[model samples]
Target: MADLFFESIEGVKKPYIDSLQRLLKQLRSPFAEGDDVGIKLHWGERGNRSFLPPDYAREIAAWLMDRGAKPFVFDTTVLYSGGRRTAQDSLNTAASHGYTAEFLECPVIIADGMDGKNVVSIPAGYKHFPTVQVCNIFEQAKGFVIFSHVKGHMVSLFGGAIKNLSMGFASRAQKQRMHSDYHPVLNKKKCTRCGLCVEICSTKAATISEPEYPKYDLKKCIGCAQCIAMCPEMALQIFWNSDMTVFQEKLVETAAAVWKKIQNKSVVINALLNITEECDCLPGKNHIIGRDLGFISGYHPVAVDEESLKKTGTDIFEKAHPGIPWQRQFTYAREIGF
Candidate 1:
């Protein structure tokens, strides 16, 4: 029900600040001064240096503070073990990025608490999940805002507020449930008797055939996609046709969940920048696939994501990866009337 506002900036210059200030004005309408605002975001990955710069986020924080709204920037721990593993560790990542005690007006808090444990469940309404484990901070905050760095992802293909809510705000168990759909099922015939996948799997989702290559149990898998990423024979593949639609539906349902939970209490804005080949959670820096588009803000998360995708040019990333499709999310969102 919110109009998505967009500003396409070629560079992160004065234009970025102007656009962000404009967005804050738009989002402040239904609320008043002295509200506690929670800004949910992905604080870049461990080694993945492609996330939104702290300087930009700092400006947004300043804008909220200027309006008398107390703001806290936050992100939860990762479902997989790596960077931002604990609340303390996450704090360090934020500090290292200049979102320090000395810089930003308020301290960053991990929404899901330490080790991703803080959560409040919202019952589903004919959706894929029975309930969603949203972190307590997001649930209890007087107001909420999502600051997503829109980019290509291996799972959902494209991620914005909708994807962020579905995956980003979830507890590890909820994340495990969201990611449960697209696991790699190894083919015995394609097995080259190589030991790479088994050795490289972070979750031990696969077991070596010993006489042949490794075979994935699928049951033990977390669908982290590492084995497929490390596959030499290209034997491991997520069940695109069968499971992708399910993944999309879950994303839509989770978006609806986020919308319902926050209702009039939340807004989302996406920064279409550093358009990398992989997620910001990637361990290494990647080349930007697209130009740095600007910022777009909206109360309707689905609409914002839809518009953000259009701004990225209508090319599906699957043509480049041939491994995923982004339309699944939009299609499902439309079907669910988001």
Candidate 2:
């Protein structure tokens, strides 16, 4: 069997769902009958217009059920204040985006508990993280289908299966640890003092008085980048505390740690459709950078993401987020034997 499987949407007479069905048929399943499988995916932030519909997730869940493996769709709470900051808010957002149990034919849940306390620390032994913390679902599900949306990300250049396993499964505190390397720096010339940044800030770090420019309290900032990504005037830029590559390395380390535990019974799939210039975590209509390609699947997150990047081409992401050392994710993955 091929190490990677791809189904392109070009010139196909059938609908995209058919294409995905064909792709699913090609991949080998590692699951045994009656196993509990977790279909991990992002359901888009509230008000985001570019996220992939839940139709694909329904298909994946149905496929697992057909194979006699019970499946559930899940995502973890995020660090930033938004529709997904709390488990209840995240589930509500998921339901709003059509990820409800009735719609997807599976239970939708927050992997981390209601208050984000259900978590476990796993051994990473990597330079950045000697141990990585993530949702405590590793023992409950016998298998996982790492379904990720392939799109541009401001810090990582692109988001794919690697990111899905890393940030997607991370606990709120772990997410903050990975994000702590950078903070928002304002470009006063571009500042409109609209207070949008202050409004979107999850932490009280960003503040403004009646007529003063917005001030960022570095001590209070958790570096979730919500302010930087949602700044309407594009006034905020990333201020890295160390080499920017450190962030990429930390991302890979976390994913590698999770992969180590789940590698035996996990498959990775990257949906190359939507190919937007920004992640679905941001709440606006992001610019589409590539035409709707299709899907790619592989046994490893690194390989699947690398293939997704190749299919989409690096230039698109580089142009979208210049000067990011995204390649470090792959190189560091190899170094740590992930």
Return the top candidate by lDDT: 2
TM-score, candidate 2, is 0.83
Query: What clash pairs does model 1 have?
Result: 193-213
The residue-level lDDT of candidate 2 at 210 comes to 84
> Each candidate's TM vs. the true structure?
0.78, 0.83
Tens-place lDDT digits, model 2, residues 114-212:
867798999999898888889999878999999999999988999999999999998866776787655878899999999988997878999999899
C-alpha local distance difference test of each model:
0.71, 0.88
Cand. 2 Cα-lDDT: 0.88
Candidate 2 has its poorest 10 consecutive residues by lDDT at 233-242
**Across residues 173-195, which tens digit of lDDT does each residue of candidate 1 receive?**
56656666547767767768678
The C-alpha stretches of model 2 lying farther than 4 A from their native spots are 12-15, 181-242
Clashes of each: 1, 0
